[model samples]
Target: MDVSSIAVVGIVLLIFGYGLFKRTDVSDAFCEGAKDGVKTAFELLPTLCYLMLAISMLRASGALEALVRAVSPLTEKIGFPAEVLPLAILRPVSGSGALSLLEDILNRFGADSFVGRTASVLMASTETTFYTVAVYFGAVKAKKPRKALAASLAGDLSAFMLSALAVRLIFG
Candidate 1:
């Protein structure tokens, strides 16, 4: 470890040892905190389950595929490879689904193909915005995550655009 981290760890151990010497009831506070953490985890479980089921249903219902098809022509017009369009659309909803699509593309078209390469770049650089921010912040009971969610989506969009442009310029 770095010198600062080592020093910090040493200081923490010193303080902890001193706490034991002074016989402070720190254990009670830690136990209480752990109890609260368990309560919070239990409270969030149902919400997390619902979100997972909903996302899974969206994937299985072919609604995601419809979305992909609807947007395919526009993306194609903008010079994105048509084959990668489904992954681009679904990437924000469910990461596993997106990765499946990307893997299928790579397997069928070959990893070095333009479509596979572009999807890899896009997937690598982009975040699973809607699934991540919405589920995480909502589960955590954050009151004002609207701005954070917007920013995450914006970043994903920017990365998606950049990946598309890079692929088109470099390999189209």
Candidate 2:
């Protein structure tokens, strides 16, 4: 196994040993934690399902493609490929959707192509902003997340622009 795997194992063992030393009921503690996790998962399930359904509808209805086409002019002028615009837009909302789009880009433009490299960099740079905010804020029961959502979307835009620029500078 890799060093990181070994480190994780060591950490787990250390925590277990510490619990034993403290005379804590480790098994009961673990069970309680697992129950809490299950409760949280149930709480988040509806949100997750809604997100997946929305993504599917967006793709199936061709709304995503229309949005890409609508932004093509500006993207083309900014040196960003119109083809990867969908990936950039989806990256902030859904990781799996963006990943599928990335795979399509890699397949269509060859992994070694400039577009492919930019997409790869973009995938690394950005986060699933909406999904993360939904899950985390939902977990914490935060009702007002406007400021956090705005900040996360802004960061995602910056990462998208920088990824495109960096790929161009490095590869060209």
Candidate 3:
């Protein structure tokens, strides 16, 4: 195995051994943790489902494409490729959706093309902000995440702009 994988296994073994040495019921603790994880997953299920449905409908309805086209002139003026716009929009809400769009960008533009590289950088730099906030806050039962959401989205926008600039400066 790779060093990282071996290190993780070693750490887990150490923790398990320490628990045993401390006379802790490790198996029961593990089972309790698994049950809690399952409960958290169930609690976040509805929000995840709703977000997936919304992302699907957004793509299927051609709204995303229309939005990209509508903003193309502005993006072009700013040296951003219109093709990467969908990735920027979808990245904040859904990782899988953003990945699928990134794959499409790579396929259409070629992996080494400026647009493809920019998409990759943007994907790497940004977070699935909405999905993360929804799952984490939902798990913690926090009702007000407006500030966090705003900050996360602002960071995403900065990442999008900076990725485009970086790719252009380095590759163009």
Identify the leading candidate in terms of lDDT: 3
lDDT for position 76 in model 1: 78
Model 2: which ten-residue window has the lowest total lDDT? Answer: 47-56
Give candidates' CA RMSD values in order.
10.0, 7.0, 6.9
Task: Report the alpha-carbon TM-score of model 2 versus the true structure.
Answer: 0.61
lDDT digits (tens) for residues 24-70 of candidate 1: 77688668878999998787667656555765676579776687688
- CA lDDT, every prediction? 0.76, 0.83, 0.84
- Error of model 2, residue 7, in angstroms: 19
Worst 10 residues of 3 by lDDT: 47-56
Write down the TM-score of every candidate: 0.55, 0.61, 0.62
Please give, for residues 72-156, the per-residue lDDT of candidate 3 as tens digits: 9999998888879878877987776676677667887898998889999999998889989888888876689999899988888
Winner on lDDT between 2 and 3 is 3
Where model 3 places Cα greater than 4 Å from the true spot, the runs are: 1-67
Query: For model 2, how does the per-residue alpha-carbon lDDT over 1-172 read when each residue is reduced to its tens digit?
Result: 7775999999999999999999999999999999999998687667656665766677679887798789889998888977788888778877766766787678878888988999999998888898888888888855789999999888888888888899888778
Question: Which pairs in model 2 have colliding backbones?
Answer: none
Looking at model 1, residue 91 earns an lDDT score of 89
Off by over 4 Å in 2: 1-70
Ranking by lDDT: 3, 2, 1
lDDT score, residue 41, model 3?
70
